[model samples]
Target: MHIAPLSPDDPSELGGYELLGRIGQGGMGQVYLGESPGGEPAAVKVIKPSIVDSETRLRFAQEVEILKTIWGARIAALLDADPEADPPWLATEYVEGLDLSRHVASHGPLDALLTASLGATLAEALATVHKQGLLHRDLKPANVLLGPNGPKVIDFGLAVFAESSVSLTAANTVVGTPSCMPPEQANGEKPLTPAVDVYALGAVLLFASTGHAPYRADNIHLLFHQVVDASIAPDLSGAPEELVPLLTAMLAHRPQDRPALDDVIRRCRALIEARGLKVAQARRRLTNFTAAPAHVLDDLLAVDRPATPGSTARARAGAADVPPGQGESEPEMLAPEAAQQEPGGFRPDRQEPEPPHTPPMPPAPVPRPTDPRLLFARIDTPTPPPAGTTTDEAAVKPDRSRPSARPAPRGGTGTGGGSSAPRRSLRHSAQARITAQRLREAYAANSPF
Candidate 1:
């Protein structure tokens, strides 16, 4: 919700739109608050040049085509786009409000009526996407904007052509946040169906109702396993009793077990009707509930420009009440290799303020070696003499007397290569023993023995 001032490196203009500031940093690009020539406010999302490869361009173009087909009140409409631009950029109606994730984090969880109304509107929006043969592969709470009008689902960066002919990302490349990922996605299933989004929406609604995802883990790898394992049921302890049954169906492990979008909308409507309110009345209630804080922003950006349709002026104001340093945490991106094996990692309910600029990807986790000898052998350290063996029996000194022979070829062993192999083996064995002893001592304090 915070609108950070544009940095020196950020372009002041893109595709003729005047860039105001940054709305938020995403995996593929930076979203800027921009003003069109006609004075209409737009959310301009430009692909980072560093990431603009041929495949990425193709994907962006496909997304543009998909967006062209999508039109819904609950979804942000695509305003303009230039897929052939230097880095390629697209603009959508800027929904000025807080993301559901940060809103729930700063304020407490929403009541049942509000949660049900949000779920129904979002489900209808997704239904439109599915009707066009598109799937919003990433549907977390952060992607839903609590705008002045109502909840509008934004960020289609991870959307995919759900039909048989197209695949946007590479094979086995895992995308989407860990906490909200469906079992099929977590297990690397291809040609995903609309049910994946249904499962994610369940996670989003759960967070809206209870302030946490169904699953939690110490690291991304463990979270992936929890999501994929059928034996592990989601922890639904804190969910509202009325909503638990619907959340359970939507969060089902198997795609077939989950309800279709229409069914989901039906159930959500039923919940609202039970509260003695029509769907429209409940939606207005939701709009009023979330829009209360946005009024404060009328003065903050008053001088920028008069409000237009879906202006970004209200975003910073709606989020103004969130205490400094209490914003939602940035999602963890799982590398391709990690995706196939461990899937991904995530933090639940933690707050990390968004950096003013996009941050570089963090280094991958270090692989733990199973064999100490293999680890020690890779390093060029000298091998010590073995226990109970004197230097005369074990030490092999390279002769400094002779002119040092030309360094060995890439894979060739040097002079005395055969002898060196045996010495190296002995050294590795000795080092392995020492490492084992040290490790045992270091862990002895916690050992049952």
Candidate 2:
């Protein structure tokens, strides 16, 4: 927010991607929208060679060389980059939706389902990056892209590895957005484990649900004090009931205290699917309304804004066909039919799948986590799905006959806390809710985020 907007008035050039218009600028650098000779679009980040230094640029160039080896749709595609080029430039896929920070500011806090869906997706993406032996040292709202497929995590310029950097001194140089950063990051500590990303994601979910971070201040020093000492919990009054548990586990102070990315995705996705079922009902009840701007200023109350265009539009249109007054608020307990079910719950995402199921495009997982930290593959790579499990399970029509199993995270690191077990099981969403509730109760006694 401190930086000025990158305007079209300036016509600068970098390598092959001709700078079309300035996108925006921050402390570290300025980004411009550009297009290749093939007319493919790209977001080119242009940073001063002096600010980052020749040695830094070379180090970064090496990262770019490694980035070329990666291929994933969820991640912004890295077309071309030049660290050795004057002022240094990195270009990634030009995603259409606004960045998470801009999206939140313009649209206000995200609805429960949207936030949960995004949380799950981002965790999966992070897992992919970590698996490639690369460390995304900086992860914040600005780096996440909101797309029809879900949230696409962007920016790997700050990526480091066990061999990439010679010193842990990189952390002390001060990178990362302060508010969303974890305690270890804000304190200038080095050799940060994957836990830091978990902590950051938790903080992001908090911001999405509550529209505020764990702490805030004009001065970075003060913010760090609050992050380190105050233990000030976020006010979750605005968060959905089911997501509280996952958020609390993510924001745990100690690195070990936080859940791994895979668990984070599993828990968040379960909550999302549950809320998605209700969105069907919510769509029906949105009577007596007018079209609003793409941006929403008020989202604290879970207001039913009309769905966005594209795939979501079709989904919402179908959902709106449900009759009114069918039900209100989530059930305090499952109905008799739900109780009689196999896992004993309402599982819309699972079942045999009915007709007209809208599926999201599958994105490739991040290539690998390069690194100082031990990167594990089973935790992030896509499993040859179990027998009878189709590659596109999540996209299937609503089916209540079969019980719901937790959706597997498509990308991101798997929980590697040992014993080769996921930090969380893809259990029934309802059971996960029960477990989350207990965790939330414990967190309530201790902290809110």
Each model's TM-score? 0.66, 0.59
Candidate 2 whole-model C-alpha lDDT, 0 to 1: 0.54
lDDT of 2 by residue, 181-267 (tens): 877767766677888788888778778767788677899888878787635764456676777888778877778888988888777
Error of 1 at 164 (Å): 2.2
Candidate 1 per-residue lDDT over residues 50-129, each given as its tens digit: 99998889889987887888888888999999999997999999887678886676556888988999999999999998
Query: Can you tell me which runs of candidate 1 are displaced by over 4 Å?
Result: 292-449
Instruction: Score candidate 2 by TM-score against the native.
Output: 0.59
User: What RMSD, rounded to one decimal, does every model reach?
Assistant: 23.5, 21.2
Candidate number of the best lDDT: 1
Model 1 earns a TM-score of: 0.66
Q: Model 2, stretches more than 4 Å misplaced?
A: 1-9, 49-52, 162-165, 168-172, 230-237, 276-449
